[model samples]
Target chain A: MKNLIKNFFAVEEVSAHCDGPCGVYDPADARIKAEAVLSMTKKILAMAAPDPSDAAAVVAYNNTMSRYIAIKEDQAHGTKTDILVLWTDFFKPQHLEATPDLHDKIWKATKLCSACKTTVSLESAEALMAAVEDIHNIFWAAKGRDVAYYTAS
Target chain B: MQKYPENAGFFEYVLLLLGRRKRIRVTGASMLPGLKDGDELFVDPYAYVATHPEEGDIVLAWHPREADLKIIKRVSMVLDNGCWLVGDNPAESTDSSQYGIFAFKRIVGKVTSRS
Candidate 1:
């Protein structure tokens, strides 16, 4: 009976899973996609004015916007993934202890990121960028670096 | 120095190495300028274990049929059903548009470092 109790209470070694923090986050991935979204918006607006007879331009504009929409969806997914990684792997218990607002900022950014997928608008894309910038701010703050300026359009 | 006759072997060493989340070097240009063709990269399997892959992050995934060939690409979009991935160099890459979004399980790890 004692042996059984000992077996039940055995201390097994817990394996470490994450490769300690290696700076890998890139905002360009999201920036380029957002720029594409903004450009598509401009194209759509330009094509809307002085209606072109070549229907091709309109079709092209529509296709470009569609692609941009797809890209936005992709960017949103990336943002969520990055946020999750930081929240789960990078932001240790020490981070929470250091910055109490970290959790709230991450949650807000994630929520805004999901919203980017549900709609197709420059404003929505901008909102997504804003959220990412917020995350970047928090990330830099956690790392004790001067918050890198991210100008999102 | 006293010799320990029954020490851990090579296979044990390899097992230990694989046991931890290790980074591997990406050797193809399929990912291009952003993650130069041949760059050392670290991966964190546990980081995105619970969450799904997102856009912009590079991921190492298995070839759906082959399983042996590991492909690396930037995530373009993630749907409830699958994830859309693309190579940085569109000119010479076969990606989500060609094969459709892939099942999430195929992803091995997220690239965490590059040098």
Candidate 2:
């Protein structure tokens, strides 16, 4: 009965796959944005605390700090999005076979980006950069290239 | 060699009554809830041959840049040239948002039913 039904139905198989085309993926995008996150983190950490009684200094300090924090959060988010796009779209199962820890690395990198957004931690920001550089090496290695990792800062 | 590819035998019977239907295996988490991974779907290749696909239709289309890659996404907007396709699960989907809109000609079939 199964053979008869299979022959009668004649179902040709198709696949409902997801992939982002254009063949233009680069880890540099994530690197640059993540670098901004690190830069902003450093600026925020290095900024001198204003005297509470000096109203003008307090106001100016607050404004500058807020701006730095905003930029850090925004850039961290952009970096996260870029990393995720590369993780899901650019890297495939074949790449996973080569780099078995790819998923763990991406997971930690994105987590660090989130940490950068939530806190003003220099360590987290630096870790994010290191993670992105690791991914950069993996990405270029997949393409059979030896691209050097550089920072805008 | 077989007359038809992908398990379609030489002695075909269903094609005459059903137009053209192919079994599509869902391969990603994009169409979750409605369609899960490994779900088999029947796609009608001739559904949009005569008329353009309307918005809200689930379609099996070729990846705009990669001719051989097939993607299943819902028609979000019907544009002048093509359609903006989005997956049901936004977090997991890399659709029109990432690669831009897909042209009408790239669409291969419309999903009819799940098996």
Candidate 3:
């Protein structure tokens, strides 16, 4: 029977699947998320301090600032996740031969992510963006692809 | 079109000695874009009996991590100690990168043709 024949030859071929951890990775993922964090920080800083005399104005300002902080927090974490995935999955041990400081760079970049989420400073957010750009350049270079630098306007 | 062994062992050797290749059904995606899961191929065990596997050849070898496990991977590089076996789809494969080099004796056969 066809079923019997199929079962007879069904040899389990063990595949690495790259362990299902590696695939095409793009640094643009971290860039966009870091951008969100920066944009949120800027918006929060630009919001006028609510009128102290008006309870509603104070509440409105508080609500808006909290929302911006929440977005920044989420996106900052997302940036960290994107960077870590590319670092762990895409980059191989051989990549370190090309970019000798890649490990230190990733370490500092991830730490920047935490700083952005913990603080409302635009400076830290911009620093996170810079770190992500560094990673992006390294990633593209490893792939022999040319990509333009990401900037915040 | 003859009945093959349920467990590929002595019967495969018997068939090879008879000048016929053994058929094996691929069950993984490590060789993606070339070989797929469920694709059938004729393995020429005698192909390397008098020789050695060259780079870029797809080979069936015992998993270095486990003795009973068998894996299908490409010979990326032949090192002084052993061969560096890697899967075409590294993202899902656990090859030389994870388990180190594969010993020459572990290689079972060479995948000659696919159907």
Candidate 4:
């Protein structure tokens, strides 16, 4: 029994499992990408010129689309990582206790981020922001004392 | 719990964990029915080095510009300039048609299992 107790106490705590509370993350990082996706969707819809028989338009359009895709991909992943960090590192048991639906909201947000590819529409991007806002609200509420200082500065 | 030697630094520990590719559960319905939204997938980081994927093979590729993100899609066409990729869903996916061909280096690993 003594050995068991000793072994349990000796266990090393795991670090780096979650992104800690540092005001380093920006919601704009995701917003910028979402905006780009929306713009690209509009471009695709508004393209009036016929598909160029010559290789030039094909090349240009392809290149632009490639860049857009890359940006969207980056944003989607960034949001995922950010949300994960918030859930694992930032949110505490008290926050969950206060906001009973926090878990569901986070899960739905993560799922929406992944499911964005389902449509080329901007709805996914909008949904992501909405979810992030909910989290931000809870996060700010959790730090009620700090909020005043943060805003004043 | 026995503690191993503490020589490994933070980055070293991270590399060790990331060094061995992990099989993660696929949680999106984009691939759908075939590779169900929540199916398990084995991602071998080194698989791309051994064999470049062919059409119809599902793959996980690094999202360009962000090293942490992974995007999974199927190869629709392999052109000399680049590979054309598209999601299984026609109306829903914004794949090669929307984004054009993904460069070869972006590819990470091909999905080995759905179970």
Cα-based TM-score, every candidate: 0.41, 0.55, 0.58, 0.42
Q: Chain A TM-scores, one per candidate?
A: 0.62, 0.85, 0.83, 0.67
Model 4, docking class: incorrect
The better candidate by lDDT, 2 or 3, is 2
lDDT of 4 by residue, A52-127 (tens): 7968888887777667666666667667777777677556566778999988988998887776544455677667
Query: lDDT values of the candidates?
Result: 0.59, 0.80, 0.77, 0.57
Question: Against the true structure, what is every candidate's RMSD?
Answer: 17.2, 9.8, 12.0, 19.0
Tell me how far the alpha carbon of residue A8 in candidate 2 is from the true structure, in angstroms, after superposition: 36
lDDT, residue B68, model 4: 79
Ranking by lDDT: 2, 3, 1, 4
Residue range with the least summed lDDT across 10 consecutive positions in model 4 chain B: B1-10
Worst 10 residues of 1 chain B by lDDT: B1-10
**Interface CA RMSD, all predictions:** 16.1, 6.0, 5.6, 14.8
Could you report the DockQ of all the candidates, in the order they appear?
0.02, 0.21, 0.22, 0.02
Tens-place lDDT digits, model 4, residues B28-101: 43453355455544445676786567777777765544457566678887777657876564333445665677
Comparing candidate 2 with candidate 3, which one achieves the higher TM-score? 3
Q: Which stretches of candidate 2 lie over 4 Å from their true place?
A: A1-21, B1-115
Model 1: residues with Cα > 4 Å off, grouped in runs: A1-55, B1-115
Where does the lowest 10-residue lDDT sum fall in candidate 1 chain A? A10-19
CA-based DockQ, model 2? 0.21
